[model samples]
Target: MPKNIYFIALCLLCIWGCRESASKAGANKKDSINKVVQDAAHEIAGNFSDQRSLRFSANRLDSFFTRYDSLRTFQKDLTTFYTERNYAFAWYSDSGLTEQASHLYVRLENLPEEGLNLVLPYKHTLDSLINAANTQTLEQKSETELLLTSLYFFFAQRVWAGLEESATQKIDWLMPRKKLSYSALLDSVLKQGNTANVKEPVYRQYNLLKEYLKKYKAIPASSTTISLPGNKPIRPGDTSPEIVKLRKKLFLLGDLTNAGDTSSDTYDSTLLTAVKRFQRRHGLSEDGIAGAGLIRELNIPVPQLIEKIMVNMERNRWLPTDVRGRYLAVNIPEFVLHAYYDDSLLWNMNVVVGKDVNKTVIFAGSISQVVFSPYWNVPASILKKEILPGIQKNPNYLEKNHMEWNGPDVRQKPGPWNSLGQVKFLFPNSHSIYLHDTPSKSLFQESKRAFSHGCIRVANPKFLAQYILRDDAAWTTDRINKAMASGKEQYVAVKDPIPVYITYFTAWVDRQGDLNFREDIYKRDAQLSSLLMKR
Candidate 1:
């Protein structure tokens, strides 16, 4: 046998004996499993005289299968994975453990700091294993290598891929969760051949959130929550002690540049400017008034904001990486529709999303059609909940609303009052939700705009229509206006499919590189916050 291989066999034999002693010493359950692993390693070592034997020694790992039941849903996958790889040390070289192994171990240790819920075991031991003195001998080197690989899988599953699909569905997040191939990711890590480039492959937003996470974490935690005493908006000439408190709060939150001046209790021009900046960063009215809306945002503590940032970071992990093509994303909480072409924001406008009771689903679809002057085929739920009640109050509800029964289903005629307004962007989805124009434009002016039944209501339909049909040569400004003016329902098929995501993120970074937080209208943040608190 090769000298190092022989030495490894002797170490495994010792490990087997030590596990037996530990079992006798009442380390019962896990020590017995360790004994099985040690035995399998030794049993396979006899045939390890050549690389050929090592390459074909898959059967030896079967006895230790029960040892990994803690891996839960990943157990069977781990089995087939190890068997296919012939139980070889995945992150090791013949001489010693590879550098990528250490990189992975450190990342696992830092996972919690990156907003992960669970804490990885044996971080200190893993750090000790990389110490200079521990590597003096090759004893137990392969075992350490395998242990690190297993830990890497555990960390990647929890932190990068997020909780299972059912768990995410419970939180009402319907966006497709991203999946990662551990083997492929490790292969790329190994291919890099250096520690400098080793990183967890996640969505682009993950990196952006990390930068903001650092910024938020730098703010010191407040000792006590302070409330601004006001039932109304503070005007420019208003004088109160609350103005001084508001100034300090905005300064702490980075809305004010100077923290040195605290001499005045009046809402001066400088204070008004800072308040306006703060209001703009938030999705509130930027009218330079410290109203209840602005004050509520101001009083949110740094720690709560940090938790919000971390929770959104977890959501970022579930985002698709390839957002390069032309796409329209509607952030439900922010009430904004962003048009992006290859990661660059083409334009953005206000939008009204579903209310608390009728939440717009968080999912993706391909927008393949745009309908102009569309009829509103009211959903059955709406018909039962709204139309029936309205009919009970007034028999002329159908005539007043210009709705007629067509083959037992009620639909409104295409016109100014048609619930879908002048245009509707169709993206085939099971949820039956799409973006459409609405006659109620006043709702868009509200800071909190969750008024629709389910579909999104775009504030600027003409702007969106023009931007969407820009590529089609046949559709010109005059033609689009003429088509919209024809007072007829028209369906225009989009040449290229644009991916649209109806997302729910209460906290997100805007195009101006500013961190913005909105009201948790659907109350999803608490559910995610609970999930993230699970150790």
Candidate 2:
């Protein structure tokens, strides 16, 4: 019995020894994987600091473009970007690919949010490298590095550079295109390790529009469409089945802030306020009534709004990265002029732009002088079209309108009845467009105020005169008012010239952070949209 017990005990001891050995082997294997992961991470962190260890032959870049035909357009830029870094591998490290590669991948995936529908030629190859199971060492390192560089340029061009200068010129957008060195921008982004921290890449408005794009995109594609039952205007305190639809629609559009009782069909006070707000945003008369114009704006689909936002984003990309310390900005579609001092908006006012047949030119200039009680020297186009024909019809037309011939040209005497009103702000350009006041004050009361003959008509010209001369100690408020009411033409040079940008934006985010859309009265959006989509 003792011998039998010893035999069983010996077998039990052998089994325990084998189990211990197997457990140790499993532990060693896990430790090996952990070491690999740690080494890869350390190597990636070191790649940015160690330049010499991550370079490849320049010939590889030449070869990459040959294989990737779609990226061939970026060959010149990639060459310059790499030559500046001495053919260094920007995306790879000693052990594996870096974090920026992953970041760029994510950005490329979300290109639509940037309002870009670009296609990456070697995206599948990039996908394989990033999503590979083996995270220790990257294979096809040369191809991967070139692919990443090309993509970086792609993103910068699409987001920052926008369409070429020629494209904008074709569409009559003459504002100087924002210039940027992608190589330098990439260096800064790499140093920070986050693209979001870099605002210099594009105009400030681009970021704002990007936020709204994400918001609008998050809305369901199948949102409810509101339809009114009748053509009659829906006024306040009137109950109709369409009131519920209006409430829900307004709430979704961010016009109606409070979500109170959306189920109620009654057009209550809350609905009235929301309708007025909507009217103000769309540049319609704030009557607080649901009319044809209001309903048309409300029925605009979310997708169409998204497209409008995208178009403006492209336009924003064309703006310079910085505005001067003091500047004037006139948005044609908005029919508004904004004054800025040191990048802060000082004030804004309604203005009348050119009619559709006489569209205002989009360009930039400097406000070098302000002419108070200015003479209205008519342009040749106007003289041939209106003044001369009027004189032929009525021999006393020029004299009746308080005008007389100044040499070969006709001029209106400076007074309240003058076509230029009390003041005209001049910035010399070939287009001959300028900011002036109109005697027709009633035009300012209208919602759509595009009635000028190319020159912008300021609503509050006296205030503009005071603001322009505020810094000039020689010209006080009383002096400015006297000069404006003097009834004598006087040209006063601006103490300091302020830059002026005449822009066209059908959609933009206002100072209140609300997305605002205006009519494409000049019919400019369609042409720009078509160009963007074809790409």
Candidate 3:
């Protein structure tokens, strides 16, 4: 043979060898894909067929099927699995099957069997992919297996996060350092294999939940009460310096007679003063006489007052967290209104709250607007029941009281006799109530002034109007006085809206931290106290 002929032969032989090697490589890859598909099918079948091993196998099979199409030559098996109900050769392979098998193993690790139920509907596609993978190349099979594994791990993490969030409850007040014994609880919950293990991280996430349960469970359902000390009487001729000092502390200067000596009066000034002071403190008229009301006030022990304050503080905590920053704080027991700004008391004054039958509600809202010399839109209950009856008895009742009837509405003309005082600070409430100046100035003189239909009665209307109008260029003390003096009904618009919160608090700590107690006119404290005990 010639040299050219020999060279041509060698080239042909090299080409043939490369083609043969390529063919072998392709077969090995197909074999690997087939094996993965077979293993995945077995998992699916075992999951659905065997009761004990069903859950784990199903999850493993679902994970494998999700990535089945990514395997080379596995696409045919995947399609067939969905089209046909074959399971045995679903994941069959010719060569390199062990590499793809490793990927499937990793995918099944740490995933609970309970999660497999979510994947049962796609069993056919999983079966098909397993059966078709037998013809895939080695490289294709390895890539498909790795891709499936990655997807399984990603989905598993999501499942775990969701389960943790559901099982763990966030508690706001639990201390962070406290430890919880949740291992037993976890064991109980996991007996059916429906949930994951209560891992160390899970315990950390649920610490707050555990702490709250413990705290709530430990709280006693009843409150303990203590009795007050009985009152001691002061006698004449027994004028010790201490008794005289005590008498002076209890009584007003006017109530004291023959201050230096204890022997000169028909009624002992010291005893009378003590009685007056006691009466004043207990929402009774500060009369020197030890009347029924005065005696009652003196009998209430100091400790009971402290208990009332503590209970009200707890009630305050029950209020919504976002209470208005600048709002009216009406101490019902103190019969006072303290305007609060930035959580500090700006100014305070004595106030007349609603009557016992028409007690003020405990609620929160904004003072949307202020109505100057506003009309008292009397409540329906008061209108039909009280005013209507009075009008019937005396047809001239409206004219005499400077009240005009406009259909069902009754308007009070601006004057001393008007039910609403000279200037009313209007903070509209849903309960059809407002904080306004009252014409019944004498009511403010009473020690316990719970006489309103429902509105708050202010003692000094001019002062409140001045405070509110300070920011307005158009409103001033002079402007307000002119409006009221005009004698015709006028409305002064507030430049800025102030929030008003009409709350019923019988107990609270004063600016001095001195615990103050108000009379439980509505008896809400008693009810709440009972509830606290039950808790």
Best TM-score goes to which candidate?
A: 2
Model 1 error, position 346 (Å)? 0.8
In order, the Cα lDDT scores of the candidates are 0.75, 0.84, 0.50
| Positional deviation of residue 13's Cα in model 2 after best superposition, in angstroms | 61
Better of 1 and 3 by lDDT: 1
Q: List candidate 2 segments past 4 Å from native.
A: 1-51, 133-139, 220-222, 258-260
Per-residue CA lDDT of model 2 for 1-535, tens digit only, reads 6553555566556556656565677987656655755564444454334543677787887677878888888898888978877888777655566666677788888888888777765777888866762453433777777887888888988888899999899999998888888888887777656666566567788888889898888766666666666768888888888889899888888888878757889998888888988887888889898988899999888888888899999998988877768899999999999998766899999999999989999999999899999999989999999999999999999989999999999999999899999999999999999999899999988889999889999999989888888789998888888998899999999989888999999887778888888999998989999999887
Give candidate 1's total backbone clashes.
Answer: 0
Descending-TM-score candidate ranking: 2, 1, 3
Error of 3 at 22 (Å): 68
lDDT tens digits, residues 85-108, model 1? 566555655445556677776677
Residue-pair clashes per candidate: 0, 0, 34
Model 3 Cα RMSD, 1 decimal: 22.8
Clashing pairs in 1: none
If both were scored by TM-score, which would come out higher, candidate 1 or candidate 3?
Answer: 1
How do the residues 1-535 of candidate 3 rate in per-residue lDDT, one tens digit apiece?
A: 9554565566556556556565677987656655755664454333233212211222334555465533333333333332332222212233333333333333344222212113322345434444556765543453344334333333333222222221211211111122222323222322322223323223121222233223323333232211222333434444344444444333322223344643333346557655564555455655555444443543354344434543443343334333445667676767888897766678888899888788776555555455565666566786789778989999998787777777778776777667776667655555676778876787777777888887788888878877777788778678878776565666666767776656666644355422234577877667655543442
Positional deviation of 360 in candidate 2, in angstroms?
A: 0.8
